[model samples]
Target: MSTPEEVAPDADAVTRFDDLGISGPVLAAVRDLGYETPSPIQLATIPTLLGGRDVVGMAQTGTGKTAAFALPILERLDIAQKTPQALVLAPTRELALQVSEAFESYSARMKGVHLLPVYGGQGYGQQLSALRRGVHVVVGTPGRIMDHLAKGTLDLSELKYLVLDEADEMLKMGFAEDVEQILAQTPEDKQVALFSATMPAPIRRLAQQYLRDPEEIAIASKTTTNTNITQRYLVVSYAQKIDALTRILEVEIFDGMIVFVRTRNETETVAEKLRARGYSAAAISGDVTQVQRERTVSQLKAGKLDILVATDVAARGLDVERITHVVNFDIPTDTESYVHRIGRTGRAGRTGDAISFITPRERYLLKHIEKATRQTPTQMQLPSTEDVNVTRLARFDDAITAALEETARIEAFRDIVAHYVRNHNVPEGDVAAALAVVAQGETPLLLNPDDDPLAKAVEADGRPRRDAKERAERGPRTERRGRGDYAPYRIEVGRRHRVEPRQIVGALANEGGLGRDDFGAITIRPDFSIVELPVNLDAVVLDKLQGTRISGRLIEIKPDRGRAPRREDRGSSYDRPRRGDDRPGSDKPRKPRHKR
Candidate 1:
């Protein structure tokens, strides 16, 4: 329940894992895992944790914080006396399983060491049997840990180390009490290491009450996204997403890739679409069996699979070295998920590319993500038709070269073709051309791309452009009479909620990041309200407005479906202004009575 003051390190002393005095077996396993340089968190926290001091590490998600405390625990554990020497608590079952898997990987050379993951929705018999057989480390969620403790099945009496991974997320999921109960069961002398992306007040209080003077190590998140990654996005309407994604897959050269979607349904749909286009693709989600998930991931790692379409939950903690790109088929709902989505690539110090498909209305989310990650994404325009043709032909050439390599005896066939040309008294070029036509199957070898619509209708920024024909067909029309550059949007708040125009405008300007000039009209009805906002609003601005409150009511803003008609569709002050009038007119200037 208490910790001692942290032992401070000497100034300006830099050390590697080897210099930090890690055991030979552990260091060997680390090197075998292909990690040469230590991350900043590892460099700062490893020495202290190795020195048997309680430590608190603050770092972003993909910063290799796992190895910082994991290695020290591995080095300190006695192989023979395996009665749960260490307990690493994670927030979710996925994270717990990943942590245990990592321990197994790092302890490859450490014989007789067993790490078990205990979490909810899993059988107790396996965990109980593993305990009976004596496990060295137990990684799990707090709820299951507390269950074992209450049942007197887990022997934390012999536990020497405790780790709280992602403490803030744990607290958010209402595990604070369980964590405290579990901590109280461990020996007071146990070395506790807490790592969180953020140190919220509750976690700070928990640390203050539980951890002895802990060494504070904070690694500020980078001001920008990983420089090793080339980030770009494609803007297309929601309906055109599949076509756009197919075109990009045709143009981009990659080894293996993961395409992230938002829903379980979408994972299958996207993967099927890619498969129909001849991609070796698969879909994964939480609904799949563990065996299926493992097989899918194994296929991805072994280069048997080219594209994996998955939802975030199914893809958590997946580390595959062959992953060359991560495509966000649908933008993540939040920035933290976005960071983790891209982190699947650009690992092991290898340069990677991350592409996303966004609609025009969703560009605001791009700006929101940019402010969150400190990286401005460039839009990838559609590939030119000629460019696509060239790429396809090059692939065809590669296919031909590979086929020729496999057909070592094609020389005889070539001689026969030469004999045929001579006998027919035809040009050799003409004979070769006939063979190519036969080999091309249904698709032509040299396609004329001049008729491609995207050649002229796609802008550099991925936005749609009108061609001359379309522009000529849709003749010009007069602009709206009132509200310059503002479009009518409806909100749920209304006269029933005592909504007011000034309150709506104030909320839009202050909470929605809109200017006063951007608002034009506001009308509150019995159950809904309509307001005007500048056209082409920023995504962040729209999101903020959607969550804004006036009179303690949520402003769920959506495009006005041509505002509901009233007896006065003939004359509403906010709808439109009359000619020769400086302002909109109403038949009844005095506010009408409400039904409620």
Candidate 2:
């Protein structure tokens, strides 16, 4: 893949890293680092940093933001001076190491650039030695650097630049005082650069006090769900999503899938359950070692594993095209992560799908996601009895067809059928009926004979169809209620747009602030749909929804008056004459006038 700079030349249409108009040495270094274009933050901040200006950058993870300020520090490094010319402070030990590595990548073209990462977890012996050797750049966590400062092992007398990466996260983690003290230890005139995902009040105040009229650049979270993904969300309870996910897997023809959970422990638990159910699934999380994490990701990409239950941090830099689905086993904390989660699939322009499980309590979050992503998730109902039956029949048909195609003993079965028909002297029609009855009885299709089996199964499990074993556990629940009570309100889209019920829900939830549970029964037709929303909607909501469009057509929401109106009432009441007579009064007055 091309470097961020080379690929996105007009990151914000300012000077990209490659086009930064920096010294030849710096440009060469960037080229050697394999960067073709600067990231958005880099393109925005590089020019100012090179011009000796301080900056405040508001960006999120995975945006290559470290290189934005790191490159400029390298450009201005005074090799002859040899003193620490730049100091980068990170919130966490992990981030400090990452920043130090980035600095090294940018300075590879420079000789004797000497960069050191100082953090608390590692031995102090190495850090002290590096500081004593007088490195040009010092990248360390807030606490460790302060300790070194107190011990007089590190010096910032010659510091020219200072960077605080993920400043807000650090502040949240209770590193504010440490950060402030470290800043105090730096040179008074040092150019400070602060980068954070969110600009909370404290962070902004710190930037205002410390930074020198800094330029602020904020990249709002990207809301584009991969167009290649056919995204859906199933409304299942917290306790039931596991069962529901299994059921969905059984019905869906996914080649590979990634299941995202919020916590590391949950990753392991969910993966174990999936494995116990005989799926080719595994767990990956922050607690796992580098080797194991890499191995897990590799297995997934190689198609050795069908499912991966992972946390967000563990799944970083993962790209797999065959990932046909992404299951948000637990909802993401924020919108940005949701975009990244779905982005794992739908790569290389290949079409994929994503499904999320939303519980009743998470309906608000479901609406929030829809608003952020601009797509509503379909409010999935419990699968209906009829729907489940149909799906089961379809599965049964497929199984029978496969058996007939692959089995070599067709003659044996044929002979048995012939013997039975001849011995019983049965009519050919009667024989076929008997065979049909036997075949149907053996299959699960007729369990809920009058409903869609998949729908019934989903409703019974309170999730989507996952795998076979889960279905066994959900066997023979109370039959679902009839779908006949639904009243359809016409939504005006039709066959021209190729819109599905899920798309409609996603659009509404994403755009109209509707939740997954906000909708009732939905009836999709070739050209239009008569969907049911909750009864007795307030006028404000109705008015707000008036003149809206779904699937590129105007959705005129009105009361469903089932038939054509009578012609007489169509005219205004003012247009009809009154029943009282006027001719008699006029005639009596005329007669009196004639007599006079």
Candidate 3:
């Protein structure tokens, strides 16, 4: 019933969480999490919530909305009362779990406080046990909460506070009826907080129907994309993405990065590939346990991990200040997801970068994202071998400079070098070069320009050499055996693992950082597969591919010295007949001898 209040965009206005009237325990927890200043949404909503007035907050997903509502709730909680006094309803299981985790972190110093997250896919027995033991706060999805309410397992007679997070998403998900039912069961006197990115007609009507004359707070932004972040997208073929990513990683100076992918399997695949390429990377998905996910996030925050491969659900409500880059490995289908994925970086007015991989067919999605965000991403050029070499040389120089700071250690090494030069009657320059070679070890100091597919793929003007779709249609060219362009290499995954040629090619291309032209014919035998690769493949690259996995089995690739393995038992007699098999006089059986 009241006009919405516009919060000042300047976060510096509010220096501390304590200034918002947050209690000592809650402030302690905030400090523990390294949060110094309150966000605009928090500055506007926390005081109002602490004053016991209902609040309607309008903000985007990554604007610290969880903390905005959570801090106030923690400050006002009656820890001694074991019954659920506060309930938070979210649209998805991921959001519910995230909210519960936030509550847990904020109440770490507070004793006698219990929190439970209830959602589908989790055992009901766990919820029943937690309810019987009594909890101070309950965070859950509307459907599961409705089920519990219908079964008379949850009581809201004494509830004091209720919050609906991402209310617009809940409505979009068709949870309006369940949300209304849950709201009807709550106590009439309970304070409510509704937060949404956008308020639709139905949301407005629901607020009018349920909420008491609430104070409205809106955190306005001119655009969805952060101004501090440099947005860029590279037009690359699907097969060339990993190589492009590796080249970018070699060139960009980033403290931490999150590579967003579409599916749970991609998180593991990408993370595994990155780790194989000598990166400190880990994967987080719905399948990963909450504790492991938390640990992985914590490691990223602490700078122990440099890269995190994550799905959208696993990364919900993730706030880490050290995240300097966000890579959309697979572009999101929806614009909102794109916004959320890139929102992980450029937080708190810090500078960051967002790079996306856009295939030719997915170019339309980029246009949609640009239209929605009102910001066009600049076209990015894949780093050339020379560019990577420059970066490598600079890093090598910096390492030497850093080592020079340790005078005693450098002197020791210098004396050893001098002794070697004197004993071998070799020039000091040659000795230094030999020492540099020793220091470089297995990894090459400079990437071979000829082996750099990304450099050749991108033209001088920063456009792909050929259209991705056209190249895909043309397919990989067959290798001429004796011309020395391709050589046979054997991998350990084959028919036994139901491994397909496409899978082997994908694994090799991604892990080995090779292009489509770099691959030759692939033969899938019973126990192992023989694939042709560039004869000039770097030994280091081969070593890296030795750890490449297909169907969860390590490839362990080695040069194929002997002839190709026989494929005599390729087709089984028990296999079902194909459509054409029964239509003509084919050697294949019309029917299986027995049902497989």
Candidate 4:
């Protein structure tokens, strides 16, 4: 399909809120937020949206794109009507909540204005109560929105504006069908705005089918990886991440940092461990109040706190200039998230550092991010205890020198020390040494991180870390199984059929009714693929899968010769290696990145 013509936004546009015909409470809110000018996306989108036209905006995360559409929606909102005049569909619940908060913040002075953010996991009673109370704006994820519509709790009759934010991500998460279904239920004359960082074919088709005479605008963000940020990656097994993270933390020179974890529970778990290890750390998650979150962030900025362990939601829309580092304790699910995570640091012409912990299996995503960003992150080696010790020594020396620079305080202390030395007849150096011991406190002067159980596991039984992870026993694959092992089965679709692992997985999950827990290793070879199924497989499942057509051919399942297929040899996929290709994800249970 041909791409739509881009209406390029003027990078040097001299647009103001007043110039764009925005006034009243919305403008006052903007001024309160200290926004002096509109961004490129805002300049291009706000005017068209305010003029009551459909808009297709293209911009990356952190590009001030939220304000672009939010301001216009607020300006046109009928505060007195309040029956869901505007609907925003975000891919994740975190984004939905953030957008809802932004709407509330921007419409603070607009009397009678009400906004509601609906998503999964939140109690339905709370959302139902808000909707019954006659909210003016509704923001939600596709699943929860569909739920509300199905239950008739959410109404769209008065919806004048509908926004599909992060459309590409929603499509990626298998929400394209849900999105279309929801769009079908919206008012026919609704002003639709679809925004995405990258316009894949599916999103394009969705836009073509829905948006009418759209004002397409592209905000050309600099997608280049900031050279000022040093990016590094560590490939470790899932069980070893916490240990590896601690070692990295010990070695890196950072002022204030954000450690990104996948879940709220992980944030607390990691923060507690870091605190136990003598680091000033706090966990930020959805559980924390807004006041507590702000306090923690303020403390982080003031250097009273050093590390923040945050879930995706708590970290959303967070802008703290003092963030010197960002550690992805768990790898992000997608390339866009990776970009956004690293973007947390390295802002405003300041240098920053980003470190990502990669599991062996997740290497595919790493390669995807590298290709997207066009910069291969340097592979990081685990820091030794000596490295930590040296860094600690250097910092200690710097602190002592700074203390000595305080002339008045040091002179007073110096006289007290001299008097003590004179009275005790102890050598001056001995007296100073005793005080140094006090200053050192109870913290270990040096750590032998090599002796850590986590590190020991990596080197367990004299096996190399890579060997330990790669060869760990999960279960028997089709070719690897002996006569008694879980029976191996062959599906006549493989590399020759251009069948990827995900496609095979989908077929098994959809047709066989087997969950991920039921499956074992999948080996896709040139002509056929081998997968391990249950020993006494269900007759119904086998019957359903007997003739499942894949890649234009009916998939045929059969007993396999008990010899392992060339598993995704990863390095070359075969011993006859020739070219450049490496698969990184090792056999580990990756915690699924629950959206929001």
Judging by TM-score against the true structure, name the best candidate. Answer: 4
TM-score of 2: 0.44
Residues 456-486, candidate 1, lDDT per residue (tens digit)?
A: 4335225443543554455421232245577
Prediction RMSDs, each to the true structure: 15.2, 22.9, 15.3, 12.9
Candidate 3: list runs displaced more than 4 Å.
222-596
lDDT of 1: 0.73
- Pairs of residues clashing in candidate 1: 3-212, 4-212, 4-213, 364-539
Candidate 4 global lDDT: 0.72
**Which wins on TM-score, candidate 1 or candidate 3?**
3
On residues 400-515, what C-alpha lDDT tens digit does candidate 4 reach at each position? 89998999999999999989988999999898778878988877677876566555543432222233244235322233344354567788877867765544554554345343
Point out the higher-scoring one by TM-score: 3 or 4: 4
- For model 4, the superposed segments whose C-alpha errors exceed 4 Å read 1-10, 223-226, 233-248, 255-277, 281-351, 356-596
Better by lDDT, candidate 4 or 2: 4
Across 1-596, the per-residue lDDT of candidate 3 in tens digits comes to 58989875664554678888996888987876567788788888899999999999987665677888888888888877877899999866556876787787788778888999987546567888999999889999776676577567888888999999988777654466668878999889999999987877778888899999999888764336777888999877555777789889999989999999876778999899898988999999757888999999999999999999997767878999999999998876445567888999999999989999876434545555665577889987788788999999999999989999999998898889888988999999998888799888988899888886556654422453354466446643331234377788888877778776545654565455454456665766678877888887767568667756566566789999985334554422221122233221223433423312
lDDT of each: 0.73, 0.66, 0.76, 0.72
Candidate numbers sorted by TM-score from highest down: 4, 3, 1, 2
- Positional deviation of 8 in candidate 2, in angstroms? 14
Worst window of 10 by summed lDDT in candidate 2: 573-582
Candidate 3 has an lDDT of: 0.76
TM-scores for all candidates: the values are 0.47, 0.44, 0.49, 0.55
